[model samples]
Target: MGWHIEGTYFENCNCDSICPCATSGLTAPADYERCQVELAFHVDTGEINGIQVGGLTVCLIGDAPQQMSDGGWKIGVLMDAAASPEQAEALGSVFGGQAGGPMAGLAPLIGEMVGMESHEINYSDDGRRHRIQVGDAVNVDVEDFVSPLDPTELGVRVSGIGFPADTLAAGTGTTATVDVFGMEWDNAGKNSFSAPFAWAA
Candidate 1:
């Protein structure tokens, strides 16, 4: 059995300017030497082990100690409530790094799996702005940067070491709040961005 997923992805972390997690493979020291963050994904189309996963949403909320690559991330996962039992299990395996795929690359970075649950997930994108909500666990809003030279155009496109490598739109978090997995943080106006992504295994 194999799987492939492609869609939109974004994240909000309590970091300044560029987030080191993307470049250094480890998160830089944040307000308290830890990176509290929320990552969301909207699967426009996907499947795992023959299960359809299109149009579902998922989220990861947690914190990284010291550097992300140092491997001590305590996190929880939230899947769309609309997913059936089988779909939910498939999503859990994929995102939890148990199914071996693009997500397997991230398996080593997670030190603990605090929890996993199905929740009402809301996600939307209106060209320049993106919004995501995972039940009452997380909420985030981000707006793309407008080109300084040409306000009519979008901001710079970023390319780097992960999914959505070339289509990232640089942006700032208008609001980021999370309360789950024994972690609590608010990173309003922090580092955030959105992009289209594709992954397979």
Candidate 2:
């Protein structure tokens, strides 16, 4: 069986400007602790073996405990409500650390399934900027990068990886966190990145 899907991805980490690890080639915390990135993806144009899949949301949990290599990665997945059984299985497999693609390579480091959350997702694009909402779990809103000193704006770019997303993100009035495999994540940022990507077949 074969499948292909196209859509956009968004992510925000606890790292400071430039997320040093991405370019500086340095490990997280540059000392003892690790760096974590909570990535949320929305599939605007998606399909599985010819099935029309739209409005499906998924998230990825990434980290660089010992730099890029040395493995030790963990990932958590969330499936949309509209997904059928087959679609759910496909998504689970692809995101559950199977297939050995970009995410697959990081599966070995997964700690555990921190459980999945079913929340409403709202997205809109007004050409110049885009907006995303996590309903109840969390709220992710971003317009565009203009200036660096701007209080509610973050000016940065990551070329292809959707870097420098949401110059300023404010977490809603909630405590959203995921802890597993000795790793803990507190969703506090209100802005993230949205980009398109594809894994191996």
Candidate 3:
């Protein structure tokens, strides 16, 4: 039987609407002048080949020219600092496109592999407060959506996600930028976003 891995991930890109890459579009340039994405993954129930796995997070920072599929892509993966060597290896395997799954399908389109780093991922949601951060280079905090009455709040929800609903996102800083061949972009945005597939580890 085919394997199913359930997880959540948040991506920040420099494109407007949905990133072209996700929809198999390679037109002009991506909507945003620059692009930066911080993806955090939590693998709940899954296995790669035969290795049992637990929670793991991967952060990807990349740059692509307007049209996705054009090619050039620089990517870096951040793993949970607490994982063991086996876990780390598994993380790399899954994130690196070696596991032969939905993500691996994109491997051929990716250009730069910035390697993988170990980190500690902490995500929490308290009533109306939500927090997610990766080591230090990336961080996201969301509060009740403004404009709503005192008792309730309404902001923006990513098209279909539930946890990070209608929240504003900010970044600490961008450590690097990449663009080459087909893919190209400079990712940098501190705006509110709501899109499908924001959380899929």
| TM-score for each candidate, following the candidate numbering | 0.92, 0.65, 0.64
- Among all candidates shown, the one with the greatest TM-score: 1
Model 2, poorest ten-residue lDDT window? 164-173
lDDT scores in order: 0.81, 0.52, 0.50
Write out the backbone clash pairs for model 2.
9-195, 10-193, 73-109, 154-167, 169-190
Index of the highest-lDDT prediction = 1
Badly placed stretches (over 4 Å) of model 3 are: 1-3, 16-28, 125-130, 142-201
In model 1, which residue pairs have backbone atoms overlapping below 3 Å? 27-68
Which residues of candidate 1, in runs, are more than 4 Å off?
A: 27-32, 164-167
**Candidates sorted by lDDT, descending order?**
1, 2, 3
Q: What would you estimate as the lDDT of candidate 3?
A: 0.50
TM-score of 3: 0.64
Cα lDDT of model 3 by residue, 103-163, tens digit: 6756886887866667687754443444456665556553433444434444433232233
Candidate 3: residue 65 lDDT (0-100): 47
Tell me the tens digit of each residue's lDDT in model 1 across 1-201: 889888888888888645666654444445448888888889999988999999998898877875666788888998899999999998888888889876777888788899987889999988678899887878899887777798668676667656435457777889888887788888888888788888777
